[model samples]
Target: MSKYGLGSPLKVVKKPGETLTLSCRGSGSSFGCCSMHWIRQQAGKPLVWMGCVNSDSSGNDYSESFKSRTEIIRDNSKSMVYLKLSGLTAEDSAVYYCARNSL
Candidate 1:
């Protein structure tokens, strides 16, 4: 199979103490591995380095601030990546980005 742009893009919005889940579709291919990345943006600026979860790699990488509050999970069977944020607050209200890696 050939790798292309994201087939599906999702967004979630929540108030304080609420939960949200964003989803992405992976390309159906075996040559390249699959991965998902999460980013946060505030005040219309690019604060995109929130964290990243590599599905194919089977581990997670996060920014220092998010280490204690964020978790990333991957389900290879469905080609899905999940971002779970608990104990939400006003400070957590920012745009979330999820990207799939084809390599």
Candidate 2:
């Protein structure tokens, strides 16, 4: 394991257009990780790649549906990452996962 896990383990519920935040944190890596990746997996379905933020440059990339509605906030010193999502819909009902290079 990468010593990674969510800050919260509860199921999230939100209305349309609401904001949702999922916090992720971890320690140092030996694989020379440079990015943090987010994924969503709906019930009974496969995972969907949402995006990733390059830790080196603080730059980000997002999937089409999340292009303008998602943001990554990181506190490198604390090894913490926050996934902020907005403009929600029922389709957003899924499990979110945060991962980094398992060095």
Highest lDDT model number: 2
**Model 1: CA > 4 A from native:** 1-13, 30-32
TM-score of each: 0.71, 0.84
Residue 59: error of model 2 in Å?
0.7
Kindly list the per-residue Cα lDDT of model 2 for residues 14-98, writing each as its tens digit: 9898999988876655222557788888999998888888876358889997889999877777777889999998989998988
Please report the candidate that would top TM-score against the real structure. 2
Please give the CA lDDT of all the candidate structures.
Answer: 0.64, 0.78
Q: In candidate 1, residue 5 scores what lDDT?
A: 36
RMSD of each: 4.0, 2.6
Which runs in model 2 stand beyond 4 Å of their true positions?
1-3, 29-32
